[model samples]
Target: MDNFSFYDLQPKISNFPDEVLAGLSKQQKQIPPKFFYDEYGSKIFDQICELEEYYPTRTEFGILQQHSSDIADQIGENSLIIEYGSGSSQKICFLLDSLIKPWAYMPIDISREHMLSASKTIADKYPNLKVLGVYADYTTEMLLPEYAISSVQKKVIFFPGTTIGNLEPEEAIQLLKRSAMIVGSCGGMLIGFDMKKDPQILHASYNDSKGVTAAFNINLLTRINRELEASFDTNTFTHYAFFNPQKSRIEMHLISLVEQTVVISDRLFNFLEGESIHTENSYKFSVQEIENMSERTGFKLIRFWTDPKKHFYPG
Candidate 1:
């Protein structure tokens, strides 16, 4: 297999954090979710997947293991497989084994190092396959690769790992719309979504016994301190993740233990006592909720497979 052509290895200039920060100043408080996938963040998240309490990965993988053949048949042969957030490319083998003859593989992610390493491994393993590695932040507005964008035929869009949970409802819809436009109506999308579960279960997934999730959450602050020259007391903050039943999602944040002032680039920022910086949200969906979501986004549910024991509720 040869390395495939990429749309754009570098992100568009306007996608820089300085641009984002300037834009966010117009709002009360804001943080774009793309920062969560820096190298360290990605590693910590991989640790999160290995924890006993995190059931989404195991359950979703089980469903794929059981129904890859069916899924492949539905997707058909000679189709291009484009995956979003293609971390490690761990799950692609199962689908590739089933598909047997895919036209190309496009793996997109913000972590260029990981994407580069994983894409190389994938190409080596899947001889005769065209593998294109894209290092772009899909959350930010950027032009897709010309080849993919200009293709008259639609290709399959694969968004696994339940990363869709990171998006707000409206954002998720907009993302799907962008994907649909890229793939067109002829190409379909296959996604994995974590189902809603008990608050205890949800919270434990992010605050596991190993504390890897906690480390991952705290690493965000560490990253800002290092990169943006912001002062963040990691020890003074604690990670918190809990299911909001009403919102049908698990919200993750770092709560400040006391009032504090932090300096960044010669500017001081105040934090009130017991205040928190909301970091991430993992929205867990019911089957009906996903079905409604699919319908609203002009996606017809082709098939949904799940491991019921893991509380998998695919639609």
Candidate 2:
């Protein structure tokens, strides 16, 4: 048995630099998107996955169930399976089970607990499968561990869950380019993208009536308070999300319910009543856009499948 070391992806800001802190304080209310993955936030997200309105997880999993054999056939043998944001390794099991043979399984994630838990489960179920879990964020520039994969084998990057939507166009392209460099010339990439659809359908998916998404969004502040020793009134903030047609994204925000001042260590920040801080934007993509992105980024579009009901684009 191999002993796995735990890692955290948090940026080490020893001194919350005055200028940067001041800039953040200038906003009536402000919170960065990175704070959204505390243990509580991750648990809430798992709840959101079970929600009826949240369709991406279920729809994408369904597509995999139906076409896993075909997808596995295309991937072929002796390729290392690498997944981005591989949490719990739940959805991935479908594909791996269907594959005839694979050299290794590398799941990259930001959470050390998830990486360890998921990797252990996979290792237990598939005795012969080599499992390597990387505790790092693949979105940013970082050197991947050399031992994670064999230099001689073909690489296949599995970036499912419409995660590309989290990035802007340029960032998405850069990620794809990185994938190209990692996989080399002979390999392929499989990914998922939520397709453009009716405004109502798209809007309802994120801003569900049960408000689980809202809880998850606001939970980011709670994480910041706990991790950074900051004082934030979680009850004084509310979550807001809307479809921005101009940007073609679902923008999420945390609006202050009342004016207040929060202190973090030595700095004091003030917020105006009803003001908002932008948290994240999830950009959806058209099929053509996805294909073009792949082409421009040096990956030929292998094959993509969508549910017959038109909910998502799974490849």
Candidate 3:
């Protein structure tokens, strides 16, 4: 446990309320996807990865399992590993196992409890590795841990689970550029990409039959009700997700079952029947788009590996 350190940089409580009010005030009601990671939401998302319809997680896992040795060869030895949105810390284990004498592991996530628990577990399992759990929204500008800067030989960012797909292309470029700055000129990044696939497959991934995806989507409202004192009737709002071909993405929205008004901290928001609050967008990519993004973001596409069916890419 001495090898592990935890840092909390999550936003103040008032930040959520402010963001929600501003988003709801928009002509197109929207909520930032960051809100979907409250403790409960984080647990629900772990369940989502195991669903049969969700192929990205398992597919990417397979790609890593098959090519980890080659990937490790590229990353080199004694490198610092920084994982963004490090939920559950499952994939990092494989990379750590394959890498030669990885100097440290830093798992950055918004959920404090989840980040701490996962970091501690990784530390216990790899007693020789330094584990630092950072509680911050990696999507925003963040100061990397001072110790990670001075103690490690090289930095390698492991951003798996296609989480980058959540951002628009421009936002993705900005994030990659930030990551490049964090790792410095000598560092490299191994990122996962969810490839463009059949619309049916994309739709099924977000709309699982067991309703776990629905539950995961609805957990956002439950979080708002609990944390913001928002009067959101969970039963009156249903989860809806679909692939938008024009956008090359899957959009998750919460649709109102009836006309209603909800009050959050003295702020009132109204919704008509069938009106939806846009929650998340997951953008799929092509190889060409990824190459273009990498070029714009200051990263050279040194290598990439995909699953047998080519559903996912880890590069």
Could you give candidate 3's per-residue lDDT for residues 87-199 as a string of tens digits?
78999888888989888899998767777888999999999998988998887888877878777769999999878999877888899999988988889899999999999
Ranking of models by lDDT: 3, 2, 1
Tens digit of per-residue lDDT, candidate 1, span 1-315: 355565556775344447334523432333555666677887887778878998888887888888899889988878888888887898888899899578888999877777888998998888788888888977666566777556536588888877788889999988877776677788889888887767788778777998888898888778878888878899998887787888888888778898998776676666777777777788888878888878887788878877866576433
For residue 142, model 2's alpha carbon misses the true position, in angstroms, by 3.9
Could you say which candidate leads in lDDT?
Answer: 3
Worst 10 residues of 3 by lDDT: 8-17
- On residues 1-315, what C-alpha lDDT tens digit does candidate 2 reach at each position? 453333344523333234226546664444445567667887898999989888999999999999999999999987888889898899889988998778888888876677889888888888887787777878877566666544546788898997889887899999999989889888888898988888788788889999999999988777667766888899998988889998889888888899898787678877788778777778988878888998899988878778998778766
So what's the TM-score on candidate 3? 0.92
Worst lDDT 10-window in candidate 2: 11-20
Model 3 / residue 217 / CA error / Å: 1.8
